[model samples]
Target: MSPADTGASTTVGARLPASPDSPTDSRMAPGGPGYRRMSLALFLAGVATFALLYSTQALLPLISGEFGVAAGEASWTVAAATGGLALFVLPMSALSERYGRRTVMTASLAVAVAVGVLVPFAPSIGALVVLRAVQGAALAGLPASATAYLAEEVRPRALVTAIGLFVAGNSVGGMSGRVITGWVAQEWGWRVAVGVIGALAVACAVAFRLLLPAPRHFTPGSLRPRVLLGTVRDHLANPLLRRLYAIGALFMTVFGGVYTVIGYRLTEQPFGLPQGVVGSIFLVYLVGTVSASTAGRLVGRLGRRGALYLAGGTTAAGLLLSLGDRLALVLLGLVLITAGFFAGHAVASSAVSRTATTGRAQASALYQSAYYVGSSAGSTVGALAFHSGGWAGTVGVGLLAVLGVVGITLCGTRAARVAARREPVPAH
Candidate 1:
């Protein structure tokens, strides 16, 4: 179908089908063959990218101990990858626009797999950081391209369900990767662990290539100064997008910071947890599975703003709960945080994807770039809180970041009301 046919001249947002009548719904409609195929492909892609991206994080403590680096310095291993991913956000977004989502996402995962192999071989911390940074850059491809593919292909009626699955896959992959790699490092060594994660990513990349169908729709987008500036300005002009971006960044920032502090605190602590137990905390990510799917249902019933408010409050409450030192309380907190994060991410990401009239990948890339930037920035900064006031201070920072999301939620709700009143129903 041509852009003209789909109402691309304006933001149609995304409309999903009510029910998939056949296998084709996974492919061409919701719950049809196309969707199932793409969802599987996306699941594979998520597993591969996350396994490779976070494999280093699981081994950071070991890396620091082995290399005789301080805890703060050791974190660069993870930070380097995030920084690389951030720098390429717009470029990769443009690359997908110019080439295609299928090609770009496949290549992105492929390159990340290759880069994942090198981290285990770095002879020095400096070399590891460089490798990690390069790995981060390579990791940028999947996020923007994948999000765009979903936004474009999923029937608007089914869009929320599809996005929920993709985000769930991401959360699952991230949790599993950390646990898997951390365990492997504990049993064998960091090198072997890293190598295994890379190998898995390579395998999944191949699966993604085989499974993901060719896009039903795509349009070339330019990177020239005028074109790029216009596109950026167009997205920035959306009052809702700006607020979504802010909320996304702050949500991840606080959540990422919370996770970072918990790991370090558990490593020491009045609790004195081992790495294995620390890894087990990620098991609580199971809650995210439910929340991701539930959020989709919520969006249909609650509309956009109502869902966000629920997500924000869930996140804030979760962060507060985890502040307790009791092991049971901490695990419960992790569950709450996991559920809250997925819910918020699902709603905001879908909203961002919908808000754009064109270059949806670019829109998604910007959102994710900002999202992970928060992740990297939050996790890194949280370390300082650990150094200063310990876990309580760290929780304080995380909670404060959550407050930012609350403010964004309120602003977004108000603006959306105004826009709806003025414009009535959207073009789609």
Candidate 2:
């Protein structure tokens, strides 16, 4: 929504401090108690949202068996939630902008946990899919609001580090959710596994609520359609922002596609690994936790453009490696790809917050919406590809997608350079 729609225009009296980095009000600093608390809250937010959302992923085989559905259909359990998250992210971001960040985020966590608590009780496959979709929609609140919250409240110099830590939480959460659920499902049954995850989500949600500091710098706005539409127009018109959004979409497509069917791939064929062993492969996500933090440092050292190029190259290399037939090579490839994915995501998301001139929440929301849309589409497509042509086809598609990302990013860079050259030089 537009600033006008936010009634931010009416509250123009509440202008941002002359310098964002130097807000008149006290802002959270890098190492203060408040800062640490905020980071922990966000980190737990990342954990709860991702863990609750993907908890069903590792149980697809068992779910399919109980539901009497195909793998692709079973995948809908994961897809439904992502689809719901994708659909509501923009609207939820608007809500957070209109109300307040901490309020929106805390509510999101509580609602997501509540919905997750209900999934184990779903009476049928259709009911479970419906509940998962609702759960996903509930989970949309965090990602939609987190980056914008960081942008508005954190010091500019410390922003990248904060984003990295938050994403590191996502990496750890995603990995742990799959591993825990997979192992638990093997022994106790899928219902018990999911119920345990929901319980964990409840605990994380409580921690998130207790630790999060309220937003000090946020200015609430009106949720008018005109304002929203105008804000969307501005971002879409920016060539660089458009390219960044595209990168988010393509990045997650490959990530989602690979992880969607990876369990099936490892368990079925030449590798012939057991379910728990298949789950262990996700431990590679710890590599992503490190790479995300490193990406922050890289951005500080090399700037966003340089960091993105390197991250994309790393992802491409990982995809190529995954084509190997040996089990060790496959695991190594997963580690590389997971690292590259988080690195690229951390950079791109921070870039969105940096790039937007206004409606920071909306910009972040748009990026997340694209991200989850890619996820939903990628999971389904990847499942279908794996079913048809095997892991070879899945990797092939991912490689092509990563290449497309590189091409777009490079083209955007060239355009920026050309635009720089065309600008008139100041008279000396």
Candidate 3:
């Protein structure tokens, strides 16, 4: 960040107005009802998007059985959305710069809702995948601005809390969507159950638009290829940011891969669970939600290095537990894996935001884009393994991925420590 640029944004941020209603906010001169509204909108969105998006996951076996597609092909129903989101994130970020975050995000939510409502009507598996792909792309904007909204609107002290709440929404949404779909599939049918979740998502989207406050500090984003590439290079060049991206990739890849096949696993052999039973498994996300909140305290005590190493090791343990044939072991393993992912992601996301104080939004955006890309890749690879090698193969790859995360953790911690030492102390 150049001095001129720093002065420009800081001057604007400093000029932010306060509401007359809240003397506390007026005293601190941070955000207003608008920022709070934005946060609320984002939180609700997390509930809707994840619920609607991953609802298909628990239904993977149903999709396979009904559509007569192979496990890998059915897996595309979920993977396609992730893949589309990966592609759309950057472009959506750019769109927000031009049209503004709230506008782009609201529109995106509407489109996603439309896609969800249309899902039950899809005549064939191919059509459903295509609609899912588009819906995934549409969802890209909501998550993209979600971070930018927080970073730009709230006080620095309050930003992490807001982000944490939004992520918590993701946990709740994912769990409910799967459970609802699974339960409904057991009683009604997969189409009606999934479609109802989608309808609820649409309602949530409308509420989001109505509730979210418009941006007060947003300026048009730069569309210049030169500037875009420069921003990309700047974030990528930062050692800590680079490592965080790598960690995000590794965790999501392995985590996504492992969970992607769980339905397949349960549907086979000793388990042979129904879709409702498979969906109930997502109740395990409750552990992940609890851990994500609790993990916040760890960053204050151990710092990123110790915290991340512990998390990576935890992730590995989770995968190892999944290798057991017993239902108890499988559930326990998933709980650990979800816990580790939330913890690791929380640490990594915080590290990246702190890496660049001025370009925080862009840095966070880059980080999230990599995160989803990892999800897409992981789901795809997990599908292939589930198809050919089965549970053991998926477990093998997941642990192997965690080993790489361990290496990244050691290397990154060493670098951050070196940088800390190199940073000069100012005279008191």
Candidate 2 lDDT by residue in tens digits, 1-428: 44322222111213455444554535567866499999888888888888888888888888888989887998899999999999998889989988888888888888888888789988888999999999999888889699888877776667778888899999888988888887888788888889988988888889988998877777887799999988889889987778888898888988988998888888777888877777778888899989987777898787777888888888878888888889888888888888888998999987787677588888889999888888888889889988899888788778877887899888978987897899899899
Candidate 3 structure lDDT: 0.77
lDDT of 3 by residue, 114-232 (tens): 78888888788999899889988998887757777665666545554566667777777888898889889989888998888987788788888899766666667667878767877
Model 3 residue runs over 4 Å out of place are 1-39, 421-428
* Per-model TM against the reference: 0.91, 0.94, 0.90
CA lDDT of each candidate?
A: 0.76, 0.83, 0.77
The better candidate by lDDT, 2 or 3, is 2
Instruction: Estimate the TM-score for candidate 3.
Output: 0.90
Candidate 1 CA-lDDT value: 0.76
Error of 2 at 275 (Å): 1.6
> Candidate 2 — worst ten consecutive residues by lDDT sum?
4-13
Each model's backbone clash number: 20, 6, 1
lDDT of 1 by residue, 322-376 (tens): 7787888878877877788889888888777766767687688889888888878
